[model samples]
Target: MALRHECIQRASTIGSNLKDGGPRRRWAAMLVLTSALAAPGLAFAQDDGALDIVVTAQKRSERLQEVPIAITALSADALDNAGATNFSGVVNMTPTLNSVPYVTNSDTLVLTMRGQGEADADKITKDGSVGIYVDGFHRSRAQGALFDLADVERVEVLRGPQGTLYGRNTTGGAVNIISKKPSGELGGKAQLTYGNRDYVRLLTSLDLPAWNNLSAKFSFLYSEKDGYVKNIGPSNDYGELGNLAGRVALRWDAGTGFVADYQFDKGRTRSTPPYYVNPSLVGVVPGYSDDPYQTYRPVDLPVSKTDYDNHGLTLSWDASDLVTLKSLTGYRELKAHSFTDLTVALGLPTFPYNIDQERRLKNREFTQEFQLVGHSGDGRLEYTIGLFYLDERGSNALFQNLTLPFGMGTVVTDRRVRATSESKAAFAQLTWTPPVLDDRLELTFGGRYTDDKKTAARSIVVNGFAVETDIRNRQTFNRFNPAFTANMKWTQDLTTYAKFSTGYRAGGSSEGGGDFTLTYGPEKITSYEVGLKSQWLDSHLLFNLAAYHNKIKGLQIDIPVDAFDPSIVDTQNIGSGTIQGLEVELIARPARDVSLTASYALVDTKVDTLLVPVGSAFDPAVNPGSPFAVGQNIADRFVIPFASRNTLTLSGDATFLRVGDNSFSAHADFRYQSGFYGAAGAGPAVPGREFYHAPSRETVNGRITWARALEGGSEMRVSLWGQNIFDTRNKQFIIAQGDTINGFVSQAAPYSEPATYGVELGFKF
Candidate 1:
């Protein structure tokens, strides 16, 4: 009570001083607040007396509360309680994050943060603005981004530009997945789950005890399920899954303050994509249905398969109490193939009107990083310096065939492309804290220098005839990114910070049907942010707030080519834009056995001078007498698509019963998102293009669990979980074909899952 009272009094004094004078006086008042927070007697209030979260977002372990960056960390237990088993589940729990599906294939997933993302995610030559790292290794290709989490320790989502410390291509922040390390104890766990639609999942893990300072861990998982959508075609179901994955890790304490760890992982996934349906156009055509989730076709079922392997090694040496050295090396490979029915179950009369497509992608990458960390004897100054290098290679092949209105007409295309890239960088960061001003303030400075280069070759054939040959291109880019931060403690449990940072994304040549060698420039972003993190009532309550503004230059926009060919498109450095947003998170434990949390985000985006491609092949709105001409500016016609204006999430958990050795708990979550565009052009402004408008929606998920303690410190748990409890109508994708010279029709695909219920049993020893 006394600490609370002192905090209240200090806040009152600070508020008065802030209002007493002009800009300079206000600054002085803030400094005074910092001093009050740093007072010796009040420092103890910062301790929550509960669970503490540690993260390595800055290349060093530190308390999450003390870190100046905006981050959300979730433990393994929290994830299990939320019923999250994959990457898609993470977005459902985080308000500022969104996942967009790739229309061409099911294996690829596009991620967006704070209204910043790339639209051409399906292209093999393009890379995501947001970076994904697992066990200190980067995942470069989006095609293989979503993998099952077997033994994940924690997941941290960092908001804003993290380019300076994390290196290049992090303009929209990063996601870090840290795996549980091999412990020096003997233990293991196993679980089985059964759900609706005949869904079955199994997972097992074993940890071997230490022997001569060496320990090992192994994990495996298998899952299979039936599709939610009922197909009236030759196949009985659409959107099915059968996957298998495993991992092995070994850790050795070499003695003398030195250690080494190595890990290997492999996975195979086979699945069927969601059946496509256009409810709006269903009744307009003779053979289409109005039900969004129901489809009819006579063709065979399409299937997609992906196989991947990952290898990583890390070595560390704690030379002294004040300095450490670390090295990380990794290699990853992926091969994926997908077949899709572009007709989307359309039962058109003409054979050529229906289309079928297939895609094959192979990728491999190698990365290495070295770091040196040091701190002053007084524990006031800290610094880190590192070097990074990456080499990658990939290939993409696409095949399409169409039968024309007449039996005499046939069209086909086969395209093969191969690419190679390399990147090198050097980075350094330092934070200083002086004894003056009560040691309440810290200033940080960081920067990175990167050099990137890429080369690609392409071959194309039309109707078994060579149309384009011997096409090749090469490009190189370099950038210097910097970051600055000012952090201050305003009270025993309150801290505030201001930061400015910059990030960059490499450029590449166009590998499209229209023009294979056309090139685009790199993309960059400069971001400014201010945030506050606080805990009150003896650490029982927590609140965090962050607001940011970002300036984007050389935005890359993919534009379709001749209407005669819809499969080909070109990427262009269209224009500049701005993204601004606010995020708030709150957690409270009003009672000993109950906890509640909520998050909200507001995002706004604008592109001042966007350019659109114009031509008979490009525009469905254009006819012979159309007034529009090629190269005309269409800045006002485009909107930042796939971005919701407002997103909110509310969750709660409560312990209902407790016996001598048994306990029961209930958990629930509700999420809501405002309506936004599902694709680039929203309306009829861009002819021959598809315009999809996504309606606002809400969903609810709930879970109940019971745990019992066994002998020898072992335990057992059982849980019942259900998502979309209300059977909500939420569509995942939409495609509307406008008036086109090729007599193109409309198509759309809705989300397949609906009101799924499941049960799980697990044991740990």
Candidate 2:
């Protein structure tokens, strides 16, 4: 009762402060405090003593609380309640992680975590800072990470360097997704949802015990939503997606314990072109709109369709009580064809031409892992040793069509590219629980070694002139990423730890043409971390905090070249950078029916060095015989794109269980990000313009669910959910080039989704 009174008093104080301060300041203060207060409640609800979170951070199943790593685990139920149907939704609720979907193309998804991420997704060679894995299989490319979830068991996001255990791609961190296994019980569930924009979704799952020691689970999901933009061409607004998926698992307890599972997913979509609203034209031009409001052009070309498919399998054997072996194999194919209108040619005597294009990306990967885990020295020491191997291949292509006067007809330009990469690694780790000190202190140490190789090929055809080139590159890199950590229990409910670890990202080549080497060296980082995890108030409140500093070297950067004027420009290897950040997460269940969750992250990243390309003084043919030739240099140092320096998230849920076997739950969530730059340009004249900017924005989302339990072991649930509830207007991309001489370059305007509301119906047996 006293605690409830204190909460009421605090709420009143907050309301009083809001009345006395400016709206902006008051909002900021409220967000910070609310996030701080809700963190403990959220953690407690997710990590309660009723169930233990099992994670494979070190290739071994262990309790999340005992992993000695900074991580967050979300169960399938938690994700469903949060309405995280895709990768973007997952990152939206996660701290220190952000995702950007190409405005013109929803098929392209880019993810950034811990201040380290890719600047451009258009390029084929560059890889994301963080790596994503599914069922122990590595998804080396971004396309696969954008897939929808059907029957996920749990997801674990490990922060900091995971190089010692995950290897090669763990420079920033890793995301591990565990899918649901076949159950030995016959059961099924189905869900249907309807929303604005003619949105509809259906998801169903079935589990069957086909035979003794063998079971299978089939899960499928389908979704479609009309585009927000109206396409005058065919009256089809575009934005729509459909998917089909299935999985099968077999298990046998032949004294050796073996399990094999396979999964397949196919999805396709036709999305609207990013709506680039010219702020200058808003309210000035007739029918011009911005943000929650939308406007369209009579002749705008609709985005073409894109299709993607992926299939994978996992095989594992317990071998014995002391050893385990696993193998993951997968194949993926993506095809995208679209038409982009480069110009309106408005107010002129000409019509717009289409930049008709097509792209194909394919990847085939196989990974084999062997792990030996057991106890030694009177069960005081536990250790794990692993070996890993991976192989991947990918390709892309783009084509364009232009219109000319005097009946010159149409001209087509083509660009094609391909890449193949392979890697092998070995890792080992040991954890010791000291016999003395009442087993209060545990120590862990590990290291890994990796080797990588890559090859790239490109060809371009313009005006019937064909140019082809092949670049063969082989780089063998060996890294001994090591870590040392100590976990000590100070009291019955408190634990603290400090760790030092190393992370690495392998080097790769570029796709475009350049006389110089397009490959950059690997980037290595050493991280220093200190954290504390505490459970107090009789396990009702949980507090977790971590402070980390990452020193990175050999940063890779892309420099765009001017196609119109060959001598105009190109890109190069930059220098080094550093990132320092602090993260806090809290969850508390102060009352039996109420819970709150909150998290905050503050990150500061800066560039330390710059690499500039050196060119000849003058090229008479291209430079018009000028004595001084223009070259490239890195000027805007320390600018990191796609990363918000400050972020705060807060959410709360209140559940009420009453008579008539009914329950009601209400949830509200808020997210905020500071402004940051998008591209890397010096003066903006270079082709494939380098630098762009993004403004700060905030969004709120909420949902309410009501469920009733039936007498015969069945239940029904109905939910209403809303996104972008405030209808905040934000730009996801900016194009800074104009077609005409008049400085009127068209900005490829991508607006955030307007307020959306939906109703979901779910039935379980």
Candidate 3:
């Protein structure tokens, strides 16, 4: 009680100083607040007296609060509360992340963190700036980018450069997905849902604990929804989706504190293609709707199916009190097939054809890490070291039919390509606390080095004539990413910290080549950050704020072929950029039944040297007899696409008592994003065209749940939810081009879904 009063007093003083301050007074206010927040360590401790969030940010188990870094941790409960069915839904709750999907393929997810992400997903060879890791294993294929979270434990989004501890493929940040381990308890659940548009879904899980030291859990889900577009040819227009998933785990806790576990997960999904409309004609057609874009001709002909499977084993041995060893081995495989009709080619009657594409990706990764953590000189210094390896292979095939400009038309073309990549690395990190000043201050540092190799093959066949090419490339670069962090506790309710870190991403080759073989290089970044975590007002409210500045150099950017056709465009190690931002998160529970959570992020990202392709008329002189005849410089035509500069999110949760041992709860959330461009245009002479000019938009969602107690500690829940309640019609994608005349023309139009409402029933045993 005394400590709480002291914290409130300090907070009051700091607030007063802010109201009457010049530059000096502002600094003093910050110091006072930091001191007050850092002093209440005991009161802020978790129930078990351990760190609230267990993180591997430093390659070891450290409390999220103790790690002097900017990050967001979402527990499994949070995911269930938000109704996150896929990766895109996950980003809705995480305001710092953004995902852009293509109209032709909505499953091809492009993720960006803090405005630093790949601008295009069409390229097959370019690696994403933000890396994704599952059970400590990195995923390298873009085609298999989305992963289902059937039984996930937690998700960690570590912002800024994580190259030192994570090693390679993480320029902007890293996403760590930790799946739920096998439980010793025997319990499971079943759920069923129904919504508008003929939407139906079912989910079930079962747990078996008959075997000693071994437990197995299985989960399956199936869902179907009507298409959004009107199929003029099929007479029926409704998109559909179906999914199935399963998982099993085995764990053994041997004497001497040794633990070993193995887990496997398999998932598959078949979905209808996204709806497309001509953006130039949107709003012009009265009674024309975004829902109709979801419709496609020959419905059975245009469909996409994906299969994913992964298995992993982890071994941890607490050899002694001072040293420990951990090893994780995993293998993953993914395959996808997609078919789409050429609606954009409707005007070309000579050859109205469709496209068929297939992709197969496989990866096998093995990582072994050994760390020696012990208290030296009365628990003053701590350290850890580790080694890692990864191997990935990808294969793709494309089939297209070209119609002659006249009735004579019809030519078939097929292209196949394959690529393989391997990487190895070593890393180490350490922290030193002098035990001086009553253990109020701490310091830390870390670094890592990596070597990588890649090879690719391509085959093209036309009129039974075959063309083949093979290329091999290798690169070995040593990077020493280090970090320094300091934390001081001046009071019982607050803590202040500052951190500086370095990160890196490895380079590879362009899988396909037309004219030139593009070579990509590594990208590096350095970030500096400071923040304060505090709780006051008798622990009724909590607020955390952070400010960061990142200087990115040698960033890798993909140059599209339209800018320079016939030329194999690859990633280039060019230009530098800056990202500065402030993040604030508040959680308050004024009453036992009411909770408020609000988060805001202000980000500013800019490119120093903007070098982009501009697609314009072909130039006959440059390439005689080639289709491209007009000449135009398409460089600096448009700002990089899919980057929203501003974003905001707010949510609230309320619970109330109902009739007969029953309870009801309500949840509401809102999300907003600024406008951004969709394509790249040629320079001055050929003003780059704009597609899907996504203006600022906002969405609101809400849900209500009612629960009743059953026999033997069991419970049943019924819930109702609605998404996009406003029924806002928005464009998700737009592809455009021009003909001989300089008039606007659209190649394809894709619109997002409208409002959706549904009811869910769940029972827990």
User: Tens digit of lDDT per residue, candidate 1, span 1-765?
Assistant: 454334435443433332123443333323322222211001122233332457788888887668899888777776777787878777777888887556555546768888777666656677678888888798888775566777888888898887667744578878888899999799999989999989888999999999999999999999887877677776646667667999999999988889999999999877766566655445545575655455655556666888999999999999999999999999999898977765533323222255677889899989999989889999899999999898989998889876554455667989888899899999988999978768889899999998989998899999999988879888899999999999998776899999999988888866774666777778888999999988777676677899999998887765545433456666666678888998887665545555556677888887666644443334435445334456655665555767788776666666789999999988777666776665544433544334356666666777889999999999999999998776877666555453222323544655636788999999999
Candidate ranking (lDDT, best to worst): 1, 2, 3
The 10-residue segment of model 1 with minimum total lDDT is 36-45
Please estimate how well model 2 matches the true structure, expressed as its whole-model Cα lDDT: 0.63
Residue 244 displacement in candidate 1 (angstroms): 0.2
Best by lDDT: 1
Which candidate tops TM-score?
1
14-73 per-residue lDDT for model 2 (tens digits): 334321234553464454344323321122324343323467777777765566788877
List, in order, the clash count of every candidate structure: 6, 20, 33
Per-residue lDDT over 1-765 for candidate 3, one digit per residue giving the tens place of the 0 to 100 score: 453344445444433422222443333333323222211111223432222345665656666556677777766656665666566666777667777664335466677787677655544455677778876766655553544566666777877777556634476788877776657678788888899988877777777674755566676767666766657665345344556777777777676678888877777766655555443333443333334554433444455777777787878887767667777777777777765553432221222233333333333334444344444545677776767777766776766555444355555556666666667777777778775878878777777777767666667766567754444455555566777778776566677898888777766555443432446667777889899877656566667788888887775654343321212344455556677888776554554555545556767765555332122123455334334324332233323456666665555556666788699977666666666655433222233344335655566667788989998888899989888776756566544444212322444455567788999898988
State which candidate, 2 or 3, has the greater lDDT: 2
lDDT, candidates in the order shown? 0.73, 0.63, 0.60
How much does each candidate deviate from the true structure in C-alpha RMSD?
8.3, 5.1, 7.8
Q: In model 2, how large is the Cα lDDT of residue 404? A: 50
